[model samples]
Target: MRTDYPYDLAISDLREFLARRVTHSNVLSEFQEELDSSLKRKTVPMRFIFEKFIKYTNEHKQFVPYTKDEEDMIDDLFHFWG
Candidate 1:
């Protein structure tokens, strides 16, 4: 049998693939776009969606290489989230 949650599955799979292809930032942007589109058709809050991405990315960091400079850049961006 096949499944319909391909987007979700892709997100999970890509998290691992990204470990070897950290240079491919487009995949992350595509995932974010799909997530935003899904939320736009429902009652989900933006904050919740943002948190989900943040949490997943953090949890899977072991699979991806995040340099200290990149971490600092993220921290700076997070400061403006308010």
Candidate 2:
């Protein structure tokens, strides 16, 4: 699917983040699930979706929580939209 500016950047950031941490298929699946959920919010900005995604992965424990530096790598990409 075609993606615009910061949304595309956010997806890149997410894919990169998952690339580091995903050791199994289920993790990738869960990431997709969260991404889809965030994407469904047509009214919300990408930055908020990105933040919620980070929170879900951090809190849900299906995937490992991000380290501070790891969070830094992915978190700011969507802020470019604002």
Candidate 3:
């Protein structure tokens, strides 16, 4: 069936795929691009997105590994929102 919420389904599916592809620093930027124009969200925080990515990568092995150092850097960069 054709639905008006393809972007929503795509985002949910992409989130799973992104768990295996995106690097640490690109998380926020990717999330921004994912929702930009295609979808609308209510002010999702950097920390929220970061934590979700972190949880995803933790559960699976990614093609792009997110090292501990990069994680710390992301924490510092977004700590205000964290």
Tens digit per residue, CA lDDT, model 2, 1-82: 2234445456656666766665567757766666666556522255554565567567665566669866564445434444
> What ranking of all candidate models by lDDT puts the best one first?
2, 3, 1
Off by over 4 Å in 1: 1-50, 58-62
- Which regions of candidate 3 deviate over 4 angstroms? 1-44, 63-72
Best by the lDDT measure: 2
- In candidate 2, clashing pairs total 0
> Best-fitting candidate, measured by TM-score?
2
Least well predicted 10-residue stretch by lDDT in candidate 2: 1-10
My TM-score estimates for the predictions, one after another, are 0.32, 0.42, 0.34
Give the least accurate 10-residue stretch of model 1, judged by summed lDDT.
1-10
| Candidate no. 2 TM-score | 0.42
**Per-candidate local distance difference test:** 0.45, 0.57, 0.51
lDDT (C-alpha) at residue 63 in model 1? 45
lDDT of 3 by residue, 40-75 (tens): 762324555657766757765553755675555444
